[model samples]
Target: MSDVHGRSSGTGRLVTVLAWALLLIGLWLWGRGVTGVPENPARPGTGDVAGLGTATVPLPPAAEPLGAAPPQRIDIPELGVQAPVMARGLDSRGAVDPPPFNRPDVVGWYGYGTAPGAAGAALMVGHVDTESRPAVFYKLSTLKPGETVRVVRADGRVAHFTIDDIRVLARDDFDAQQAYGPREPGRAELRLITCGGSFDRASRSYTANVVVSAYLTGTGP
Candidate 1:
């Protein structure tokens, strides 16, 4: 399939093949207790204990107004993704749980963490593909730096964010902070994450993760 740019490029083909391979591997891993899969690690809560006996530091306060409800929907015009957001938490391994294959159209928000439009970085994860087809965030990498991501909140407000950066981190070197860190201190931010880059048939997993970082730039009704 062609990318959002309508370019029949080789990269697009690789992405397609890798997507299917990734989903297959992911399903296989899920059945086997998620062992040996290149899964992204769970992000720690901001300013929380690093380990045992560590001094506690306070996290930055939310920048949004009081009572900004949880995100109900996410819309990315450039990628043509409009999906309901479901709250997801950590799995047995403490890694963020992704949406199940049965609901490929849904997105998973790290509900235990800051809500989108709240202070700090709000994380949302989605599958790059399903068993036989591309899923909600299949074209996530096609998003450009200047694009906008709109999140409709349960409260009647829409949080508008401007894409600041995008990174593809190899699973071997994935850093939780880079994926979950607030781009600017005390500012509300969002991170859209999915698997991308090369797929490893031997390991049965994708080699990298695509993390899109955006910061709150405006708001709407």
Candidate 2:
């Protein structure tokens, strides 16, 4: 698969193809390239975690209070994503990190700014390519608008979101105000990000980013 997971978040040039694509997609995919992908070397709850609205610029407004999202699976059939809910937070770059694939028994979170299901645009990102093999989110860029995305909570409650749109962008095009900025008090939005565009070997990064936006539907059985 492709190893182009996670963007540079303005690191230093996006490893040629790394930062290139996700800037617009909000730190799109990540790396490594292998099957049975290495069980996240990251111990659960080990990363210097930041609860929603912690370190992000200006700090987004508080998230809608949740009754503790029960542990469960978040699945987006269209993209073939099915991972246990764990906390995903910002990678070294301040951009949100997605849960690693293939281990959704618990819940892996990308714990950075906003909670995954909170108000505004809560995001969950993942990988699409690796130098060796394709990752869970490899095809995440291909999801069509209106496709159904599902997140099952520990309480057996499932929240369904229907995609509103999918677009590609450049790193410079990334704007937190629009991306992470809050929406109406009760408004809920979801975004899934990944790498895309042509790979520029000289730069070692992709030319653009792939983004998916969705709106909450409701929890179901």
What are the per-residue Cα lDDT tens digits for candidate 1 across 65-118? Answer: 324367899999877878999988666655568888788889998775667777
RMSD of 1: 16.4
**TM-score for candidate 1, residues paired by index:** 0.71
**Model 1 local distance difference test score:** 0.65
Candidate 1 wrongly placed segments (more than 4 Å): 1-67
Model 1 lDDT-worst window of ten? 43-52
The TM-score, computed over Cα atoms with residue i paired to residue i, of candidate 2 is 0.61
Candidate 2 minimal-lDDT segment of 10 residues = 45-54
| Winning model by TM-score | 1
Error of 1 at 77 (Å): 0.7
Q: C-alpha displacement of 46 in model 1, angstroms?
A: 29
lDDT of each: 0.65, 0.49
